[model samples]
Target chain A: MSIKLTILEQMTQVAREQGRTLAPLRDDLALLDSGLDSLGIAVLVARLEDRLGTDPFTNSEDVHFPVTLGDFVKAYENGAP
Target chain B: MALPEALSLRRHVAETQADRFLFDRAARIRIADLVRGTSLDGDPTALHGRSVLIATASQLTSALTLIELDGNARRLTILPPDIDGAHLGALIADAGIDAVVTDGETPHGLHDIPLHVACMPKVVPIDRGRPEHVRTEWVLLTSGTTGVPKMVVHSLTSLTAAIAPRADSDPLVWGTFYDIRRYGGLQIFLRAMLGGASLVLSSAGEPVAEHLLRLARHGVTHLSGTPSHWRRALMASAIGSISPRYVRLSGEIADQAILDNLRAAFPQAAIGHAYASTEAGVGFAVDDGLAGFPASYLEGGCGATEIKIVEGSLRMRSAALAARYAGARGASLRDSDGFVDTGDMVERRGDRYFFVGRKGGIINIGGLKVHPEEIEAVITRHPQVRMCLVRSRSSPVTGALVVADVVLKPTCVREEGRAQVKDEILELCRGALARHKVPASIAFVPELAVAATGKLARLS
Candidate 1:
């Protein structure tokens, strides 16, 4: 069994497409290791939503997810609808 | 039952910049004296016998400002700022103020104290046969939300219609989360003055729960609270404490949760929310605080209000409307219907409408719409963080990104260096926010700038 489109993998794809290098935020979180700030997060979410056809920036979910560097990255990939 | 003599009201007409003004109404009058004029030591029982009603200078300017004359078939609006004493003196000489009520506040530049005045209590009776519309009666100023205070002229008929149904005169005690000087406050104070109700003013930062208990102690039945005030009440609210008999929420959105809380707080009380503006008065359909405003924009049977949702915004046509703004006439947000467009954004879920946020507060980062209030709500959920500002700043690549400035909760302040709290606050935000929504920078400020009037300057 394998996880297709894990949070880290998706974040990497989006960051790469934008021509920006995402420095490793953590080995465990994989892609979200970049520790992008608020503006960075907003830009990434908007771009991710455009590419994946889902909302990554909603008020309700943002209140709960992204507690850890890895958790935030995972939530983005898993949470988008 | 004889009404209290102190409950009687009077008016004074003063020249702008004059320490002295003419009292329009005389002192207290007996039933027998009602037929006659100025029976109390030759003084009319109009001015409510108060030596002076201290108010802000702008209030005095509103009084001498303009007046409407009844002699003309139509409303003769004469309410203009007396502006200067020279102009007021000329008007006094012109016999123009035959019947005028002075604004409660003394005019501008009148630092002199021990203000003396009398009234024309008999003037209304003398002119009783004249229609109220034809008679010059009341005056008001705009809410000053748009930066400049404007004079919104109104007659007793227009102003009273908006407030009569909502007034708590039968019991006399009214509780609300509005400034006494604002429109909501004006209605309450005017009713309190007219009905002999005790005015209970709340001090800042006092838990609203305590205030509710005080109102209950005074046998208060009516209640009101704004959005921010409601949020504070939510913060201060315990499971079951003080319950009001009737609650009114206004000045912002009233959703189902708010309605539920008010209902729970005041189980038997009728809860109502209203849609009104300074220009529109208390116009629009009566909201039960249970649903979005009426599905149809325009509603009748509520009062003299006409309401409509134009282009996702609420616009209203009101007979209780104010005449005009006082200062320089700034850009008008008035729609084609002459209905002013209040900048609130509304969404329709079936027949129910929900308010999202203000249109002006909407932040567009590269055309992606984000409401700062939405983001701030998320940040506030973290216990370690208190209030937070989620705003967008110019960025070269992403167009813009959300940046946050936050204050640590009092409990978060520890003896360990500030670094610990900062780290905790940052950790909390990072966990809560998404990649795009996380603050690029979360700086702790000693305190956010709060206005003297008690509203946050989000844009400023």
Candidate 2:
């Protein structure tokens, strides 16, 4: 499976588990406004680390914080060793 | 009557009130018979005035051996079961152990001792020899880092200094989830022995349910263990089987959540948490059903022990403190003015001081220092959470990241709603803890491993 699909699947699962309905999974959708708080983002990153075997945030020192779904997916894909 | 220079366990047994028994899982021996019967093989007089080590497999025999050898041996070292076998040689040489006592096989590296007396758990009736009146030094091993444990020297006088004889204590039965070789459990053992109360000893590998059943069978009115031990007992179905009047927690931070949970579980019991260490002796016990001790304890001489906060670390001074670290451990157990530095760090809020964590147990996140226990105390406050262990995981972004493994209350275990509960717990942490201290992720665990010391298995 592609990293984008896996991230979306986990994000949907995490959102559903948290009893939050996700809006459409668009590239421009702001992650903070997509029914997931900082904690949810953290849980997502952890789950992604487990499923994808890479944590983009920990991969590099100068990596920018992802603000949108596209940026989040790009970080993981580019950071994958 | 004035207390003697050295209050021997043998002399205490002779003076104890009649009709008290010490119960292990398999056997119960009347305290009087302990003084009358012999568990030591061959001539017991051969051990008189020699340094000895009590390294028994079972706590019962250790207790039995301790009572017999206290005054007879010039020095008695109570070795806890969890001590690394590799350190035994150095420990033997350090303690000047000329003789060793064991219930079963002799401990490795100590077989060459001049006297290796085999002890039996059950005492046999034999004409007891004359009691030795010599003052014996009681040496207790302090939990240490990877090296051999530090041996703290104490006489019977210093050990029993905190135990005050009660008028109505004869009918009470005492029990503990600690191995009597450790300082915490040894305190309970000494209290029962000196106060003439029957004691229920906990054996290694005994399940919580079985231990509770034995405690119930023995009518344990006062029970003591670490907060981790109590957390496991609270989860056991057999917890409802025992109704103790006094419940005590020590050896770990007793947060308000655990105190409240214990109060809810046994409403009729008086719950308290004490501050003590192998070196500090008995600091003080807080019985107000609160987490930390009252700030008033920091004032001049609260009870027998004096408490002072020196640079955020708790320091105590009292007659109950150990004499000094035995052998050439280099560092003195106390400062120049006679204060044992209990490495527990505490923060004062309002009128009470709460334990943050150990001085050495801190984790560095990015550049900020965080105590795992400080976060655990917050996460455990959630209604659905029973217990939690916060630890550090290596991360490239932040050097180290905080994570938690939590055990939810049995009643609140709903698989479908676990994610919701996790979110709520995160929110709880976010509200109370700092941004960096908040756990990055929380995993639900069925149980947490507790060490032989009755503390959370932090290293594991």
The per-residue C-alpha lDDT of model 1 at residue B423 equals 56
Worst 10 residues of 1 chain B by lDDT: B11-20
lDDT of 1: 0.48
Q: Model 1: per-residue lDDT, tens digit, B24-109?
A: 11222122222222212222223222222223223212221221121111222232232333333333322212323343444543
Give the clashing residue pairs of candidate 2, or none.
Answer: none
In candidate 1 the C-alpha lDDT for residue B346 amounts to 76
Q: Name the weakest run of 10 consecutive residues (lDDT summed) in model 2 chain A.
A: A37-46
| Per-residue lDDT of candidate 2, residues B140-177 (tens digit) | 99877568789999887788778876877448899999
Please state the error at residue B126 of candidate 1 in Å. Answer: 19
TM-score of each: 0.55, 0.90
For model 1, chain A alone compared with the true chain A gives a TM-score of 0.48
Q: Which stretches of candidate 2 lie over 4 Å from their true place?
A: A5-47, A55-81, B1-3
Off by over 4 Å in 1: A1-81, B1-139, B143-147, B164-172, B190-199, B202-213, B234-241, B255-257, B285-288, B297-304, B327-336, B374-400, B403-459
Q: What is each predicted model's overall lDDT from 0 to 1? A: 0.48, 0.86
